[model samples]
Target: MSDKKTLQEIEKEHRDSHFAEKSMQYWRSWGSWFSWGSPVGLGLFFIETAVAAWIVAQIVK
Candidate 1:
């Protein structure tokens, strides 16, 4: 508690220059392998799965 001015009161003078985050957003930032490259991973996973299934079928048959 300052006798002259509180810290909150002093900060209020400069607060007009700052803006709040007003927009609610669902945003994708450009980044790594988990982004657009995920389909390739999924495709590879499916291919590996298919190969394993084929091997299993060959063994069973």
Candidate 2:
């Protein structure tokens, strides 16, 4: 029998050959910053609020 690749197999081989994978996709690195930024910003806001309250209390004492 003659050896031959099917259309699907040939297409798969072509697709695999042209595969492009970026170690860092567009804005992928900034993804972590976005994910972590909300929590960090919230934490800072709470800290600032607490400090402001404490300062006001101390001043009123």
Candidate 3:
């Protein structure tokens, strides 16, 4: 319940914290997923779809 914290004090505390570094690290980790993971996931999805379509075609023939 310490409501006496000044804005400058809060800003100083934030500067001393590792919040920015940790947040950047989090986004860097997800950056790989965006760069490489999405294409791999899409490739798998297309493969599965092709397999399913082929099976359906075989059954219908």
Candidate 4:
């Protein structure tokens, strides 16, 4: 018998790996902000949100 992954299996594995990487990145960023305390975390949160909103607005225009 030969060992081979089907196309669907390969796609699923790639998606799962991508999601895991994104999740790790999110948590690492969150932890970095959390370590800085509430004020700094809140500041960073607002800055990120504003940037996201601006991007969305630009896209909508």
Which candidate achieves the best TM-score against the true structure? 4
Which RMSD values do the candidates have, in order? 9.4, 9.2, 6.1, 10.6
After TM-score superposition, the amount by which residue 2's alpha carbon in candidate 1 deviates from its true location, in angstroms, is: 39
For model 3, residues 1-61, the per-residue Cα lDDT tens digits are: 8879999998988886778888899998777665535886567678889999999999999
Cα lDDT listed for each candidate:
0.63, 0.73, 0.82, 0.90
Candidate with more favorable, higher TM-score: 3 or 4? 4
Candidate 3 colliding pairs: none
Candidate 1 wrong stretches, greater than 4 Å? 1-37
Tens-place lDDT per residue, model 2, 1-61, is 8599899999998776665334355457656555536776567678889999999999999
Misplaced by over 4 Å in model 3 are 1-37
RMSD of 3: 6.1
Candidate 2 wrong stretches, greater than 4 Å: 1-37
- lDDT score at residue 55, model 4, on the 0-100 scale: 100
Extract clashing residue pairs from model 2: none
- For model 3, what is the error of residue 26's alpha carbon versus the real structure, in angstroms, after optimal superposition? 14
lDDT of 1 by residue, 7-48 (tens): 888798667434232221222322233354677656777888
Looking at candidate 3, what is the lDDT of residue 25?
90
Q: What TM-score would you give candidate 2 relative to the actual structure?
A: 0.41
